[model samples]
Target: MKGIVQLNIVQFSLIYLLLLIILYIMKRSKINQTKLLIVASLRMTVQLVLAGLILTYIFKNPHPIFVIIYLIAMIAFSIRRVLSKNKGINRNFKIALSFSLAISGLFVLSYFVMAVVQVNIFNPQYTIPLAGMIIGNAMTGVTLGMKTFMESIKTQRNKIEALLNLGVTPKKILLPYVNNALETALLPTMNNMLGMGIISLPGMMTGQILSGTLPTTAIMYQIAIMIAICTSVCLTVFSSLHFGYMTLYNKRNQIML
Candidate 1:
């Protein structure tokens, strides 16, 4: 069915109504979430509108430079967000965040596009959106892993030192918490993958179908995108753990935590 303007008004109304009701319930429950609702609404509008315009340009241009600039901006923004939320972390985390994420994320993303998907021109049409998806997933995993790793070290400093004092290597001593942090970091991406077709159709696949692609084509894109997300997130979290641990521990092998 072709789109209808009046139908969109009704759909938007229902969506906003549900959202506002949830916000009100959260406020009544003393959840301190007033700002979240406001910011979320504002962000949804600004991001979608900007994305719409940019995508139009990208679809026309499809330049590699545009793709690079976009991905770089995304990586920088994601790094800032991670650092902002987890303040008081070691300074070296800046280095860890850059190298670990850049190396692993770019590795997986490049291979996925060139080796697997094999789109013509390797254009922003294909690269930018998938790059955004992969980088965004990696950002979440990196932030969660670093945050969890740092906090775990702080909270379990006693246990860690005890193990180390008993002759356990730094790697072995930190392995448990590192594993836990990686698992926690991957949970959201994993959960989305598990719920992909059952609970909700992913935005990319749904959008493709809405724009008149065949079901088979849409499904292929969705599966490929999902695997890319999984790979980037896993690589990011794993690499960040090793990098983060090195930054936290001192030359004497004592944890700074």
Candidate 2:
């Protein structure tokens, strides 16, 4: 099989022309997202290019310290992004969010690298890319779960107060919201899994196939990664919600948030 073909600079630049279609649609729809789209596109391009350069250097150097530092940076950025989206959380909730993302993400990552892939966890090529995918998905999951849970609590504030007056435990009152949030968080990943290899080709498998990997091998890897991603998402969201909801009440069983 032939190796993957690299696109020249001109060929790659041509792809930017596709953005014109989105711009035209926004104009016709009278939407004001043109500036936002342009900014997002530019940011994505610059970030990916910078990441590519950094990864190249790390791959060549191949040190345990590089991998550890990279993973730390990724987790920190992910936690910050999640928290930034969720303003006004209490200190305990913030701690829960941080620990949940870091612990669940690292646990799944370590297991995937050491047990499933059977590679040195310090191998930047495998660990870094896989860590990005795993942690990114976990971040998204936690964000969605937290958003849904918080919104539900806000909207049902009266119902919660009524329940509390009726002697209902906070756990009984909040458990449903937690469950709903978790299900909402898992839906996207579960739906994507349902349609894999049929409705669409996922990025990792497609990239591997293009790089001349055996189709069967790529399929196995894709399946394994998807399972890992789902597990990471579940564990992170579960830990965050379970630990976080406790903070909403005090020792007197009074609702705080």
- Scored by lDDT, the top model is 2
Residue 112 C-alpha lDDT in model 2 = 93
lDDT of 2: 0.95
Per-residue lDDT tens digits for candidate 1, residues 1-257, read 44323446567667777777888798789999789888989899889879879889877877777787877887788778877877787778667777777777778778877888776435777777777888888988888887787788788878987888898778788888889999998898888888988899899988887877887998998998888888888888887777777676676877665
> lDDT tens digits, residues 1-257, model 2?
78999999999999999999999999999999899999999999999999999999998888999999999999999999999998889999999999999999999999999999999999998999999999999999999999999999999999999999999999899999999999999999999999999999999999999999999999999999999999999999999999999999987789987
Report every candidate's CA lDDT.
0.80, 0.95
True-vs-predicted CA distance for residue 91, candidate 1, Å: 2.2
The reply for model 1, stretches above 4 Å from the true place, is 1-39, 120-122
TM-scores of all candidate predictions against the true structure = 0.83, 0.96
RMSD of 1: 3.3
Model 2 clash pairs? none
**Clash count for each candidate, listed in order shown:** 0, 0
